[model samples]
Target: MSKTIFFVIAICWNISLIQAQFGFEFSDSIPVEIGNDQLKFPWSGGINHAQFSTIDYDFDGLNDLFIFDRSGNQIMLFKTIEENGDYTYKYIHNAASLFPEDLRYRVQLIDYNGDDKVDLFTYGIGGIKVYKNTGNLIDGLQWEVVKEVLKSEMPNGSFSNLFVSSVDIPALYDVDGDGDLDILTFNIGGQRIEYHKNTSVENYASTDSLIFKLENECWGKFIESDVSNSIDLNSNFGPCANNGLNIPEVTPRHSGSTVLAINLNNDNYLDLILGDVSHRNITALFNDTLHANPNAVMDSLDINFPSNTTPVDIPIFPANFYLDVNHDSIKDLIVTTNASGSSENKESVWYYKNNGTNEVPNFVFSEKGFLQNQMIENGKGALPVLVDLNNDGLKDLLIGTYFQYLDPADKISKIQCYLNTGTSSEPKFKFITDDWLSLSNSGYALRMHPTFGDLNNNAKQEMILGRADGLLSLYKKTGPGIQDYSLEEITLKDYMGEVIDVGQYASPQLFDITNNGRLDLVIGKKTAGLVYYENIGTKNQYSFKWVTDDLGAIDMGNIYQTDNYSTPHFVRHEDSLHLFVGNQIGNIHYFSNLDQDIIDDNPFVAASKNFANINTGGFSSPFVSQLTDDGRYHLFVGTDLGGLWAFVADKDSEPALKLTKQDTAEKQILVFPNPSKNGIINIKTPALKKLQLKVLNSLGQVIITKELNQPLNKIDLSTYRNGVYTLLFISDSGDFTSKKVIIK
Candidate 1:
């Protein structure tokens, strides 16, 4: 903690000015909770990649939903509860605590032992493991491991190939035409129906213990059908299956598949319904009642998804189920889909009602978020870019979610806006939308970084976005309002009109570094180096010339890329220019270019490698905001798991900390001025030798703990941020009282 490091940053759009003072020590605070956890963001945590299963778990005769969130690795139960003469699934987020603890994604619930009780089955490289249902409240709604379902040893995957059990869908069925239930599995990698027929007993009826042997490794005949007769190789990777009956039509599909066997046509045969991750769609194949059910005919299902939305390209898998949702004679189609939106992989349950006869089904779209109670997921990760889109004095939130560095077609760039409802000093937010600027799947940007500046000096700020491809694209503002943004994707060219690509992960920040009236571009890339592009042209008409790819010799390297890393935020403190850069390893590095020509290839002097001890786990992008109504600044950092943390600095002055350079605005909580004079506050308590004093921040994290043996004492909060904090007093008698203190 050096006096020279005592400078704070004030953000004005993409530009910043600061002098980190010593009076206030910045600490973490949580003003909002994502999901229903309290902050109540639009959705729960994660992408919500879920799988659906139907069963009468509550014994209500009505089917309930057994949802397996593959990403969350928890099995949630949606029970049918009768209420006010009507019945609906109990939407409580109570997940069944299975004994082996965390189950891997999918689980099959059925009468495995023919006990009429729903048993659980899970698969892995070790083969299918069975969990017998002891009773209705078996293990108090917890499924415990019972026995192994197979007798033969499954070959452990070699250096070249993966084992059968380690892959995708696994099912227990009678595909061998035998009285016993056999195993059928189909995966994306293999693209084949692997059959393991039950051989331990003549029947799988009421048998506590069971085992099976591998029968046909590829159960059906592989047919290289015409281009039009495909299952998963369509442009959208959908199962169009124009080919005739029963062959393994899914051989060409690249994404994984889900299969469920049931009597759909009531033809005394078990028909199969299929679902896939890429171009997630459900197709039906009515069995011809042959051995191994090889010759099944495909009549593509008329499934009407919510808003015509079908979840595609989930990180792991997507699934479907057949149940009589409305108690109709014909069964309906229920799918766990992450609908097409500005955001990606925001999964929810949807059902298509059966409108036709039992033999010939017609499914109509019903709901997108069917029977979902708590929707709190924002996405896989969150990256905050503070902007006031509404032209308010307050700083609004613009966060980019979906950090997986996959193909653009497979990635969804979810942009959310948490509109500031309260003033800039004491900000409260409401999630306005997840489709800000509608830049979702537009260019399929990975780890997208957005910076706003009036590059053309048109009063409105144009959005310059840097993506994983090391490219920069601008989304120019067209209308007066913040929501009036239409993306026009065009590659940014250098002075010679040559396209500029940084190799990968380009995080371009806009600011004037060469004392020019126009805004210049500084980019941080996957190599953890800074690239500078000087705007040589005027404000009205802009032309960017390549200045230097390596600015200040700043290089963080690729080793810190375990998380999304290296985003640079420029700050001007006192008479010197400073750069505060965040890295993949969750630390902010500071450097000074004092009185030096930054474009003259002079290397920046390192101020401190790890400044402020500010870490946000990983993928930490530090943002300084002029958020306080009184003028104090707050530091915000984005996390890998869709988290936005706030840090505030305690000040010594009564007035808000004066901004050395702030061109725009934003807002945290705490107060002590109401109960204090200057930085000292009087504490009144009963005289006790063993009385204890405790202080906590807004996040309920303890900050200070000490023994208070006096009735009245003075506590100095000048070194703390202005916000609501908790003060707890505990006596030796175990009596405790807590008070909310506002540090001013």
Candidate 2:
């Protein structure tokens, strides 16, 4: 009866028990911490709208972290350093800087010219800046500005929108099957995208004089007269004159516009995808090479034509990335929202299921499959990352967000994980509710993007999250998959600690049974029937003592053998205690404490009486409540068949009972050794009296009928063929239990 002894035994036994494979788990404590102290930066407003890129900048073969520090207006790198046995983050260098006053700079690293060396691209109010990697520096990698655009490249530089409007995150891709990568930047003010084609093809080493010209009429309204033989740049620089793709006025555009080029239809050609932070939907422009003519004049370029007149609308407006999350070979989209919406539409992550067909595939939305919004608070500026945190071959989602610094409300900022349960073809996921990794005081806010890599080449991926306070933290996957949790039983004395004994118990119920304004405990045991504990503790702590007098273990053996009694429910009627007893046989027996105190050794002698036989197969538990506004008590019974039955029981006498044969057949009757290899099967029932059990085959014929005298009855099925059979248990009281069994 000792809680400690029970806990120890339970833990020992459960060590070999296989847990039900569902739900996700995370670390209870942060294993690694990288804060302002290590970054040497006084926490300013944490990195907002932060972008990250992972690369082996130093040729170390290990992926290192890179981030654009918006607050400090500099690029920060967290180089991975290994000592003795621990991997730590070393503050390498602030690689480059944007216009220190302009904090909207977005950075991306890509091998722009396919030279194998990663190059840095940063865009802001100052215009697009490309930094060619000149190899790694001892403190950090060195960068040389290769191309700088401060004004519109259109003819005569007619429009100033390109230089004034905020440029979206540029997408790099080989748009025309050219070896060199091209740049596509969407101008929020111009309402168009500038496609900068890399003209220097063969020369890989030097980028000193790389010419990037504007491909006129690429995304704007076409002017047929300007297409004379070869394209002319004389009249191309007017209002909306660039070859950049124009943003449809119907489509919502904001400063947070993002562009991504991917082979959406599996067409082997890159398609354009656009998203805005405040938009309600995403737009996709399917690539159509049939309409494109690279050799045509500037105004005749086919890149502006879409297979479909209108863009393909996706549900997740602010999509972050299109990843093959299920490993299904096809890409799926991930989107997140902030708290500015309604309660039902609060900040949360969502995924669309890709129904395969490379050329314009359709995405299906799930009903119950999405992670609940409560898992992560309003993720306004936070981007969800898809990674295999546990290396379980399935991708898990990581969402990190926080409130503004020095906010009056003491809201805890943290990163939460939702592990994928389904496979690459069919994805099933659930959020880890209990084990959240708290980042208390780490920062007021986090950047939108987080990068993941095996920084130490340890086969496990580590996560680097940017904080608004200019500090970054790296979280290593400390354990395999999620944490495995199981309940353990301990000795009763150890569990009680200082509290006095109540009684031997099975199930307990906590409520103010005596209406003393303080909560009390009621427990029901197999042999003890029922016992009460008075609340004698203070506000800070709880202590209980056994009520040795009033309701001390009222024996329920007379009504039903005191074997499997459920948690007791107490209801007061006319200043009298109405006790309802539910046994394993689906019966609710009533007993009343009329005098409010036990006067005789056997309280059941005068109070015990039959109440309602709301036969709902075998009862698991029962409770009394006035479900309606009328002052009438209703007995609600929970059955072993996974159903709840309610019946009016205002009167003292038993209610009339009637149950259909089909209703009784639906209840679950215990059957064991089902796939009887030994040719023997056991059928158990809760009935104490003689019962008639019938076995039926697939056909409507009765195979066997035997009267069972004991609760445990066995039958021989050795001669029966391998198939499924039906079991029916009929008690002398006309109540029945039915189950299905298979014999192999």
Candidate 3:
């Protein structure tokens, strides 16, 4: 080697030695061991969605995760838990081979069979599939095709198309004086909804339908076959089906809407809140009378938007939660519309004040007052985050809008915060979007969601925003007045221009997937795959490692850069972190058992995706959590083509749902005090991760490895680098990787 080259190598080695000495020392720093094996999917083609439930179905108190794959045509179930404080997901059931070509959209877990066991009702293309929870866990639970049962109960020609969207079965109690558990199905394209009054006896088995035996008390068990002479709820459109303009309502008749069960009248009997998708109305139905008739009068809450409102268009909404914006026990509706009106500059939200029990209640669905005229890029409003920002009792709204080629005054994408001031009388709202600017390249806004709980146990709440540039923007609530600090900007890239934000749905969460006390950010890049960032060193500097490939022991690194992808949603289960991502072709993916590893000079771990082994078209994003079935974390996925999917985490894996964004957030992580002739770079991890170590520059061309397994790793800095040098670490177990310590 040349004398100059040898001099450079010696200098680099010394710098690596110095940096290593400065990192934190651990007592018994052990390597993180995570399960990278993929779970078995039940479906055949592809999955479009998934949801998780935290409720203990088996009374074991252990929460479960459920997945739904529409294209692949199966549902999967899984158990979530922490083994030695480290999260691991175990498969419980697989039921894919059963239903083939039956594109399942939505799912509901209820005691349909009335055995006290949670029965699952999956509704979609081929109708409904009822799965009875047979106490036999080893037998994989018994299920039957309930479509035939539904077909028998409905009136002839009532549903010529037989295709439906949403379904909400009635509670156990009979609505009318008749003793029967009446159930209703919301037939989206079927024009009208049919009622199925259960007539099962002994709470477990029923031989008769409510139509035949009107006075049956055990109506919850038997399967109703048809809706003959059944009362049509929305009968104004006649018995015809299909989306047509000649229909009574020029707007689609409840096409792609959602149904929610709530005590609309405090009658203890859960009423229905139907968010009308086509008409842009929220219809509230009261189940006070169980009289079977086409002209049965039920209350409807229809709030009119100023015609052509972007938020109320056809197929623009999925399902939304009912939050009491005014803090009244009587829950209010919080609906998510694609756009405020016409996918343009005017994007508004309606705050419908619940008026107890009235179809056309006097309550107004007014627009959410915020940064209006803020361009709604491509007709998609800011991914709203509803929470108490200032720790105020009332819930607030955070709307993040992306890319405004028109707005020059405020170039960076803005995250407008709205404080809910709805009280007893006056429901005044306040808007706060002053300091919420893109802390990075000042790119267009994409999507933003809140991350609850202070990772460091700080009293104030923190927020994580996903940008159009694949960056995870972290903000810390600091000081007495709850001032927001632009803490760290995490990007999934080693090179500057390599990170491309899909802007679909990149979900994020704080999890201890590695069992460490600190919370790490698990990012789901719709098409890109999953990336986990570890917070190491003092000051919590964020360093990411891609573990998708490492965990699966497969090479999918290049797949992350693809354009056809779905949205990725995440939720933490015990010590394990669950992620569901859909593809453009409607495929749902589920990942579990996330541990850390330093393999082949890169950090990697394993995860499972799209069970049922089916392939659904991509372009869907899945929302999963343990909050679905009264604490039983159920997985909920929504497809662009298909409707919605709900899967019970069968102590096993489920089916596929076809799907699924990228957003650009400000930059947070900085390696400053630059121009250090000695390559000493100070690294920080504000987020969290599993394993975070480092490699040193023994030489510019010839590198040296210095592994620090602790939260904070150090490297010797007394070496070369008057210009720029690399400080790389194996970030995660995914195919994509990065190197950050770019010293000046």
By TM-score, the best candidate is 1
Candidate 3: tens digits of C-alpha lDDT, residues 569-637: 544544444444555555555544333332232332323343433232334445444322233333434
| lDDT tens readout by residue for model 2, 64-89 | 55555332233445566656755554
Query: Global lDDT of each model?
Result: 0.55, 0.43, 0.38
Candidate 2 Cα deviation (angstroms), residue 283:
1.4
User: What is the lDDT for 247 in model 1?
Assistant: 26
Clashes of each: 32, 24, 186
Residue 328's C-alpha lDDT in candidate 1?
Answer: 48
Which numbered prediction scores highest in lDDT against the true structure? 1
lDDT of 2: 0.43
Candidate 2 or 1, higher TM-score: 1
- How far residue 193's Cα lies from its native spot in candidate 2, in Å, is 3.3
* Reference-based TM-score of each model: 0.50, 0.34, 0.35
Deviation from native of the Cα of residue 571 in model 1, angstroms: 14
In angstroms, the error of model 2 at 602 is: 79
Instruction: Please give the lDDT score at residue 583 for candidate 3.
Output: 54
